[model samples]
Target: MTDPISIVSTAMAEDTLRINTIGNNVSNVSSVGFKAQTLSSKGDVHSDLINNSDGRLLRTNRKLDLALQGTGFFVVDNNGQQLLSRNGSFSVNESGQLVTSNGKFLVQGRSGPINVGIDSFSIDSKGVIWVGDREVDRLLIKQPNDSMLLATAGNYSSASSREVKDGYVVYQGALESSNVDVAGEMVQLMAAQKHFSLMQRYFLLYDGLMKNGINQIGKSK
Candidate 1:
């Protein structure tokens, strides 16, 4: 059988990780396209993170803002690396190429990186970019077959080679709100903290009992 101390220590460690993940979720409640993560344990390991819920769409009324109405991610090119994201708040760079709001990455299109070149354009529901009456390019959207393959970083995510074409509608002038429920996360955080405290108290009690037993044996000798 596993030692009592080892069992309690493992449970305490799990509680600590749970509290941290809940805190992170609460902090990102207002973040755009942020997904709420939950910790799951597999066998004796307690570090499996999963996020599969979709957030609510918020209307920003800003022309460059975009939101996905279904399961999909807009592909962005950072240097040569492709990153998937749902935060569609974009801006044009000096070269007239559409990029993220921070101008760090270029938005990918069907043909490649799209350059509007100082021309006014609009994105339609089907992810098609239109300049006046001319069709420029279609946005490249993809989704992984297994959401577990995605590794999230802020509003962006990445997968190795499991991404496939996804059919999701795009809404211009909108953004996806974070899926985190602050109140629920706070409740979970408090519970995890209480569990950790209880485990610590049990550890102290066990240590004290062991010390008493050792002292009694010494006295007898």
Candidate 2:
């Protein structure tokens, strides 16, 4: 049989990891385009764990900000490389080109970069970026599978299918809010703290038992 110390140790470690994840999610609640990461059991057996989940989309109506309804990401040019993001709090650069909140260029149709020079633009239902009366460019929307995107695009090599118009469209002047649930995270934090305290007590009791057993053997010998 596995010893109590070993069993409880594993439980405590897993619980700690879960606690950390919950705290991170709670902290990033106000972060725009923040996706909530999750921890789940991979199998019925203990120690089989997985950490990843798709977060729900939140809509915020703010002009120049765009949000995807479902199953897509807006492509942004971070430095010279393209990156995927859902955060749509955008701003007009000095040169009048549309850029992300952090000043990264929003990729145009995946063919080349877009330059909306001193022009107002509106995204159409088909992800078209119309600058005034002329159609300037189209946005690249992709549905990532297998893995989530990193902060940069150069190292992101996930094989994802391009998201077409399957109920996914650009909502101008709106940003996607972080999917973290504060109430849920608080509940998990409480549970994890309780488990951690219980584990500490158990560990202390197990150590005392071993010490007592060793003393008894010494006296017997």
Which candidate ranks first by lDDT, i.e. highest? 1
Task: Give per-residue CA lDDT, model 2, range 1-221, as digits (tens).
Answer: 87889888888887888888787677778877676666665543332121223345455556576776666777676566656677777777787767776675655464566567776668876678887888877777776665654454211324454655465767776666776778887987999999999998999999999999999999999
Which portions of model 2 show Cα errors greater than 4 Å?
A: 43-62, 79-81, 94-96, 104-108, 149-161
Q: Pick the candidate with the highest TM-score.
A: 1
Quote each prediction's TM-score.
Answer: 0.90, 0.81
Question: At residue 105, what lDDT does model 2 achieve?
Answer: 62
Minimum summed lDDT over a 10-residue window in model 1 is located at 146-155
Residue pairs clashing, model 2: 62-173, 63-173
**TM-score between model 2 and native:** 0.81
List ranges where model 1 is wrong by over 4 Å. 147-153, 161-167
